[model samples]
Target chain A: MKNKLLFSLITFTTLFIMSCKQDLNDLSNETNNASNVKLVGLGIMEISYDMKTIRDYETDFSILSELDLSSVNPSEEKQHVEMVLLESGQLNLTITELNFDKKINIPHEILPDDSPKIMKTEIIGNTANFYDINGKLLGSENIPIPNHRETVDKIKEIGNKFSAEDINKTIATMQGYQFIDNLEEFIRNAPANGVQVLEQGENYVSLRMSFNKIDPRIQGASVLLIDKSINKMVGTRIYDAQDNLVQSVFFGYNKGDVQSLSAIRIEQQTHLPSGSEVKMISISQIENLKFNLNIK
Target chain B: MKNTIFKLVSFFVLFLFAQNILAQRNVAWVHGLDGDAGSWQHYNAIFDAERNINSLRTSYNTDNGITHASNQVKNSMDTFYGSNANNPLNLGIGHSMGGLMIRDVDRLTPSTNKRFGGYVTVTSPNYGAPIANSLMDGSVQNAAANACNKLNDGPLSEIFSLPYGITANLTTNVLCNKFISNDLVQDMIGTPITNYDLRVGSPTIEALKNHTNNSNIPRISIWAQESSPVHWRMFSSSEFNNDQTLVNYVNDAREIYNVFFMLNTSLAMACGVGGFWFPPCWAASALYTYRATQWYKGRSWIDDSENIWNSLIKTTRSEQQTYWAYIWIPCSYPPSLVEEKNPNPNCGQWEWREFTRWVSVNYPSDGLLPKYTQELQNIPTGNRYYVPGANHLEVRNMSNSTLNGQPNDVTKARFNEIFNRPQGDWFRTN
Candidate 1:
């Protein structure tokens, strides 16, 4: 009986080895088949990415592109928001209750000729932070937060009315959390239940409110990385209400060397509120953006 | 019997030394005129292979005279040769005017080891950079400003204006400051980039003059692409590009994107325009710091002059696990390169084809080319072609696409596949 079992095992091993060899051969053959053609394109191939840091709502955030967002963190829900600072005389974005829905003519210029265009978002929690034209804190709010809801519900409401697409993943949500702990307390710590800031350039401000306790589910910071030039968001990072920093990441760029091109800074925390996560918003959307550099 | 033994040992040692020469490629970097040895930082990062380095760095004061430049070169040679008491040296590289300096070294030093393994020029003007014509004035900033102004159709008000407008306003009968700083610029010029080309390269081209006909010395140009100046407002032109293609790369938008200073943090600090943290200069500093951190901060062993020299500094040689090792920069024409207002029509735009023409013209003249040609000549010539469609910057720096997705015309994995592939000058040569 032992001999028979040994014989069977040997046969199985031989088959396995043969299969592995065949797989490698196939892979090599495929590589060879494509070797004759140009393996590269006119430019460097773009890789996707995710949010590197928690973004503040008021400030315009542009950490990663769509390809970069997808390369770093692949998720459907995480995405970036495109925004622009409308030039109403000067820079201005007022959060009103649809006072003039009939072509209000809000003019914004994100790129040189306004390519990506500004997107308007009015999802404020009760007493949430608000920003002015320059992205500074207007005043903490304790009043009614308008249009704040879960992403899914928000998608459904806008979908039936105005072809709203689900913003699952983007540069904004490069740092996203599917689940976390200690959630309820985070909202309560804001100086006025929320803060607001001015426009997006030459005057934008960011604010941080804390909570005594938070659900680990609430990862990263409450700040949203906004695309002020484009007037959109790339991601939303949620931090623990109590702990100052579990870990934070920011967008990276190179200083004209051939060594490293892009890098994210990950700062570790020594304290509690462990396992914080971040979600990029509209990171997937950055791809749709075409710049109006006004160059030939 | 004792004599035989001694001879045998000597032969063995010689054999080992010869093996060392063939076993690994030796790459030495020479600096540009009036450049710091520190500028080799990027090269050090790109070619991490084990080899002795001879840093021929001089300061802004290096422009003092030919004697100073020559002394600096001699001192550099002494320092490099002194450092490596053992092992044979091969390969040589230079950036900008440093290219001319290396040629001088090749002419002066005929040591067997100095035969060199290869040669590379980054954004060097084999003939002469157009700006050098009027750059007789000794200041780099002034030359740069004059160049920008000429490109802008008039003397530019600031070095940091948009290229098109700057040039347009200058050309159509307005804002011409051509003569404003022309006199100050008169005494400010130094070695013309192509002066050696005229003095040396012309003779070599005339005679097809590469000594030894050693094809082992190959020339590689790494070109840094267009986006560099967006963040680095007043930095010079050659520097903005990859010193003219010795190690190709582009500016990383993630860090250098002016939006951070113009819109994002710019707005955040509008009211605090002059304070240290929020001051405009501080914001610029922040952008600069961000740029430094993006490429050189923790990535390489060398310091890529990102900060003003602080006498007190810390050095760490610990390894950093870089996810994306190499990225080829995409080729793009910078608007500034082809301004209609450019005064020197002869100054060629930074084009790959133009660069190739310059290389071909200087092929016989470059001293460092023989080393590379000799190293590769015996390999039967299947190589010697540029990676197709590869961005110039990607080969020198790790790809941004994979470096957490800054932006790209290519992917990180692909860049890595090309990047991490092994390359060396180890082919057997007769």
Candidate 2:
């Protein structure tokens, strides 16, 4: 009992000293208790396992970035599971080498004829932002086009990796790489240091990109890095057979309240000039989402 | 019968409890230079003389002899300091040189800070060995002491004196020469750093020297002596009447304890700091220093050299008797001095109560110097005292030299004095 009391006193003194030495009390950005408390889920899809504790510290540092080491062990016997959170008012999905393997069940129906259907509905208050399709914002401001240095590099590199053989008779006739230069022009580089920009607000952006034709080989890989803390598309990288990030995308966000809320949606279309007809193929959406809000 | 069974079970439980408490402590022993660690048999004899304290793993940090026997002592200490500090022996018993080694190890390495639970020293000159200078100049026979402090010419002298004689001749010459000639010694030891020099950087020694004698670690110094000069001390002294042998080691301890007692007596500041409290003088520091200089002077060197290197370094080290200048010496002078004292039997020369701070027996007064002579008659500080039948070496290590000398059915009283076997009656003297 005596020892415990003395220990408590000592611990108190140590804690007091530490607090006196540091200045870390940020009160500027406060959130409601419920808003700050993050929620983790796979949206509507329920995973078989829910591990409360993980071995992320044992995570492979082999990669410079912190990759979740939660049983990502390549061993066949152990089930590989990636845990993610679906926060309130938000549903985000990220996949891995497993990206192409699994598809999200789309709730929306598709048209039987594979004809181009253009939908132009601005995101009302803010056009949100046009990302490089890999999910990264093109720029801080939603311009008519993405900041293009990355788009050009990615498009060109992806073009070079395609083999004539992979470019089947079906895809050869399609207009795919024809607009590659135009896509390249969309990826603009970070502004020069001394250049002054008077505005730092959302600029409605519009993007029109489609793979009118794809090589038959189906060999390409890409990854997107999202900055969840600030709700921004930090970067996106694309690699071909050469295994280089031949393409990249960058973007940023600003702090605002729920009143200035936002959202993002993605769509993918792969067009191949298959037989005589454009193959009036009907393909359902590989992903979907649902949200119901009752604001007080 | 049922009660007896209950008692037995209770007894076993108590034994287990005792083991647990004891095991919680990590222990190690240290020794001063010149004393043979190889002489546990001798240590037994000394323990018997002073009252036995079985604690082992003694250390002796300084001295050419330690350097000579570094490999051996290091191995012994490694076995003792423990592979891990977590589990320790709990009790450490060191003699003259072994005691210094313990202090040094504690000073240099993390042997034990708050960890050590207890300490037992049998006649340790924690300040230093008198014959250090002589030992440096090819005089003292303790090879281990010389080897431990390969270079004792100058800064090393601060620890204590360098006593010289025939025994130190060949070894000192060879070791000193080898040390000086070596490029490594010149480079590595360009400067000699003393314990005082270390007091600034190292906290334990600083605490040992500064704070309460000891706060968390409980410690006891069992000072004992044999005034009768050993065969080697007699032959080593150039001044026929001025020699102190291994037996006089008690007096050196007397000085160290005096300081500790003084600082402890000062009161207020020094309490519960290091672990152990100074026995009598609660306020000894305001009153005295924690790790007192103890003795004012150690033995001197008698130069007998014609060669330059021999004359400069070797001769000066051998001939100087540094002990005379010590503050405690003159004040605690002879006949009139003992009477001038507080008359407390426990009071040593420094007015610090002697009670086990230092103790000596059977002075060889006739042929020895006055300091040694006085030590023989110095009232034993510890009320409890024990003696075994043997000479210096034999008394130091209780082991029998010849088969006849070995373990001759020591009386329970004698065994108690020697081992201080906690559970047994061994600690009867304490």
Please provide, for model 1 over B321-375, each residue's C-alpha lDDT reduced to its tens digit, 9 standing for 90 to 100.
2121111121111111122353444322211111000000011111111112212
Instruction: Give the chain B TM-score for each candidate.
Output: 0.37, 0.35
* Correct interface contacts retained, every candidate: 0.00, 0.00
Candidate 1 has a TM-score of 0.28
Local distance difference test values of all predictions, in order: 0.26, 0.26
Top-scoring candidate (DockQ): 1
By TM-score, who's the top model here? 1
Model 1 chain A lDDT-worst window of ten:
A108-117
Off by over 4 Å in 2: A1-296, B1-31, B35-37, B41-89, B105-115, B133-216, B227-392, B401-415, B418-430
Give the per-residue Cα lDDT of candidate 2 at A262: 15
Model 2, position B257: C-alpha lDDT score? 22
Residue B114 CA displacement from its true place in model 2, Å: 3.9
Given candidate 1, what's the lDDT at residue A155? 22
Taking chain A by itself, what TM-score does each prediction score? Answer: 0.24, 0.17
Worst 10 residues of 1 chain B by lDDT: B354-363
